[model samples]
Target: MGNWKLEVGRMAMYMSFPVVLFHYFNQPTYFEEWVTKTKRNIFPPENPQDKEAIQQLIKDMRTKQIQQFEGE
Candidate 1:
């Protein structure tokens, strides 16, 4: 009975390995979509404050890109 239980546990682990790997491999895309959806739901950019913050973020990003390009 003990051996049977061990065998069953081993089989379960083996069966779950591929599923675990698939989930791990697909985690990044899943997390990205989740974050985007959550952010959109939580902090919409309709207000003036949100719009200014977004614009400032964009300006900072553009500045960094220009600096990098000039350096390269």
Candidate 2:
């Protein structure tokens, strides 16, 4: 009877360990929240000139490439 009780206790502990681990692992930890908040605060705001500058640079590069191809 004592061995049976010990076995049951061990089994209960084994089953509960997974539940405890899952509870902790599934929840967001402090470091995760800190990193998320830090990233949100550190991200750069979109600039109005960013798109225009990118488009103009691409156009200029294409034009330069075309000129080089024609020269060749």
Candidate 3:
């Protein structure tokens, strides 16, 4: 648009802007806490009781299936 010097400066700014942003935001210290909090929110901590109940349900289903096979 302007002189050669101005065109080179504009090109440098366009290329360097994303490089600078990527460098800043990609640092672990910049985003680790947010990532951890987001993960916890998406997957709440498991409860011992819930784990036990799931295991018990699976056991009961297995036993029931075994009995059904035996009857057949």
Best by lDDT: 3
**Worst lDDT 10-window in candidate 2:** 25-34
Better of 1 and 3 by lDDT: 3
Worst 10 residues of 1 by lDDT: 25-34
Residue 52 error, candidate 3, Å: 0.6
Winner on TM-score between 1 and 2 is 2
Show model 1 residue runs off by greater than 4 Å: 1-45
lDDT per residue for candidate 1 within 8-57, as digits (tens), equals 99999999999999989787875898889899999875998888999999
Instruction: Report the lDDT tens digits of candidate 3 across residue range 1-72.
Output: 599999999999999999999998899998899999999999999999999999999999999999999999
Q: Rank the candidates by lDDT, best first.
A: 3, 1, 2
lDDT comparing candidate 1 with the true structure: 0.91
Give the residue spans of candidate 2 off by over 4 A.
28-46
lDDT of each: 0.91, 0.88, 0.97
Q: Order candidates by TM-score, high to low.
A: 3, 2, 1
Highest TM-score, which number? Answer: 3
TM-score (C-alpha) between model 2 and the true structure:
0.57
